[model samples]
Target: MRANSAAAVLLLLACSAAATAEAGGGPAVAAMFVFGDSLVDAGNNNGLVTLAKADYSPYGVDFPSGATGRFCNGGTVADHLGELLGLPLIPPYNGRFSVGSSPFCGVNYASAGSGILGDSGKLFGALFPMERQIQNFQRTVEEMRARMGESTEEFLSRSLFLICAGSNDYINNYLLPLSDKPKAYSGAAYAKLLVRRFGIQLESLYWSGGRRFLIAGLGPLGCMPSQIGAGNSSGCVDATNRLAQLFNANLRSILRRLNDSLRDARFLYWDTYSTSSDVINNFSLYGFRYPHLACCGVGRERGKFACPPLLPLECGNRSEFIFWDPFHPTDAFNAIAARRAFDGRLQRRSPMNVRELVQLPLRHQ
Candidate 1:
């Protein structure tokens, strides 16, 4: 069967989940600690002198603030996920409010070009690598301890820790020009390297009192508009996609091992690739009139660069496109993907969904 046909058949075989309501009067978890790349970034790079930012108009035109540093045209996956969990949209760690003043829902530490390795996204100029992001989280924990006093660990144990990095490691670092990583390590070898580093980061979060982890696997980076625009192939670049798969597979194995070792911890793997690929493959099913073309952006695939403050080429119906820019999905797509990862019973979220993870009993480490 053809690829689209195969996707349609799988769709029919898939199980659909109902909307999950928040637990009782408020969010099930005490808070949501987010860390990652642009996927979950919520204005963390707003004022930073970095080339990896999206704090301009047309980016958040559909959003209330007009432009809020989210790569998408409106709310992000983190925002939707938080809403479903009965928490207010988590603010960026670098936002106006300092540590203790942040809302109980938690703070977003994700930056647009961040990756698992400290060296990743260096070309972005001043981007927050994962190590630094983790450091920021450590500081946040300290602040929480100072504010919450003796109840800090107890409260944090009941919170959800969400991470969605790795894409930029491949897109911005490994595959970029003049990079020595690809030469030094094979794709599979590099994947193992990333897994090792990512494992360490999770261990750090665990040490800092995080027990519930919603770890999002990398999506099909080769299929993204940026890659498509740069490639000679008419279809999704298979090489890049293969690299992503290798990393994701290794990541799942690492998470399983961590879960086996950590008695009180619950590490839930969120399959970003499957849900996202399915939507991209069957655009009509998701109400996307154009899956390949971005809603905003200019140049090739509307993905050559970030959508500028004034891009006259932006699509009229932002909701009808799968992507807001060449690299990031539209807000509508983010919401759909977020919901699927949150409560869907399908393979998109394995072992248990984010809802199930949140509902798990909090236990001291």
Candidate 2:
């Protein structure tokens, strides 16, 4: 179901594209680079020690290879995106860049529980910091260019970088009672600070010749099963969701501004929020039955020590579930959402979908 080789992925995409073309399907993309938290994370957290791991038993139960450290029993949006782009599933950003080490096609910098602000925490215990992740990117680029020389840009330009973060900030750190309350960033103020930091980090890529960016905005945290489990009877957390909206709002403005200023740098905001909601709103169409309860759980989704551990009730069919855990999605749900993103059905895509962000030629106008 998931292909790890870029060439394999390309083959799948090509086959899928040909099938779609014959049967009247949608537009196909080029490449994909997944970055962010557990949402888009493939197995990037495998190298890091994060409490957000789904590598334990029952986590990857649905996965073909069993536990692979992916939050899902299987692949995430990154895997689906690679298939969508017609390339092999990219490898993690750390370690030696080898087919055995890293897939050598795309790089996944996402560490489980890593926040956009490079949050300090005990969960992941010094997981790859956002700044450090960027450094890894720069190092990778230098290394790639060293290997590929001029052909590097030709290869990279067609790729799509998918970034999904800031969830841990809202759900794990700032929300937890045991968390150290940082007065520096709270609510909208915190969102702004994150936005600013993101811009600075992104500038590093822009100046370094990276162009397109598929900036995946935060999904509605309040609507997540975890948020509901966190004690909100409305089935959705307004305050938490508000924080996500606040982040997305700033991101939209910031990206447009960046694109305007840079002229050629295409920074597109992938509306993970809206696209994710399509599933919540219409689950049956997507083959999901329980949109609320996670496939693997410690009973009815609320209470403590329920996740990544033994649960009273485990769904027989994870494919019928929308949420895999309180935070992560099932492989089926991830597949639907990712395909939607690829199809540009999120209403956030422009003349070019979020995938085309990297394809835009960048020049500081």
Candidate 3:
């Protein structure tokens, strides 16, 4: 099918599912727990002393909340998925809502500039690594245990765990000039190391009560505007793209292993790489005019730096652009990817799509 036609069909299905969920029927899963880096961060960086914050004008101009610290112009992929699942916006872990409330829907633990490795984005300062995010979720689980008692496990088993990370491990650490990671490990070795640690992180969450998992593979990092600008090249940086491919391949193997070994748990992988590549390669088909340039930055490809605060250089036709800033996607692109992740075929989402994963019957524990 044509890319645009497929996107339209997905959009219709998403709207129909949303309507079904809203017509007095509850969301598909109990809740959605988000983890990972900036790609899906809802606003955790706002409370942190990090350079990766987006709580200002033009950042969330297209979003309903208007600059709630999302890296995108509108909603993140996680936000769109939540809406499609008939759930309200998943609150960030740092937000006030996470403290007093039971978060029946779920909380987002993703932080901008964080990665599987603790020191991956230390250059940015004060963001939650995957380990810390899991620790925070563990605390939330404990709180839920206090409130729901014996039912906590069942509630968690029914919840969806959405993890979208690992990009920073490459962009902010391994690939960076000053970082020692490149010197310590080869590209293949680095990818293996990341997947190994990620497996450990997933196991931690599993022990903490998570059952259903939706882990997003890294997108085409080398094709981001920032990479293009950094390389001063007309196209994507091939070496960086190769690194992402390696990591994604390792991640797929790890997830299959996890699903095979972990009883009652299902770990599904979402191919962000293929989805983003499709949008980039077929930009016109997806109605995107500028797939390589950011909608909100300055410099070559408008990606030399993060989108500045209180600036008017941002693109007026945001929907026509793919990248929102140097490293993130515009809301339009995010919606496409989210829809694909939710209901795309097995080629895009291995094992099963999120819609199917959410509907899987929970075996009696």
Pick out the ten consecutive residues of candidate 1 with the lowest summed lDDT: 11-20
User: RMSD to native for every prediction?
Assistant: 10.2, 6.0, 8.1
TM-score top scorer: 3
lDDT (Cα, tens digit) per residue for candidate 3, span 1-365: 12322232232233333444543444247778899998899898898898888888888888876989899899999999998987778777786552222223677889999999999899998999999999888777766665467756766776789999899999999988888888899999999999999999999999999999999998899999999988768998888999999999999999889888888888988889999999899999999999798998888898898788857855888999999888999999989998998888744443468888887765543
lDDT of candidates 1 onward, in order: 0.78, 0.66, 0.83
In model 1, pairs of residues that clash are none
Candidate 1 wrongly placed segments (more than 4 Å)? 1-27, 98-103, 346-351, 363-365
Model 2 weakest lDDT span, ten residues long: 1-10
Per-prediction TM-score = 0.89, 0.82, 0.90
Q: Residues 145-213, candidate 1, lDDT per residue (tens digit)?
A: 554566667666667899999998898889998889989999999999999999999988898888889
Arranged by TM-score with the best first, the candidates are 3, 1, 2
Pick the lDDT winner: 3
Q: lDDT winner between 1 and 2, please give it.
A: 1
Candidate 3 stretches greater than 4 Å from native: 1-28, 98-104, 347-351, 363-365
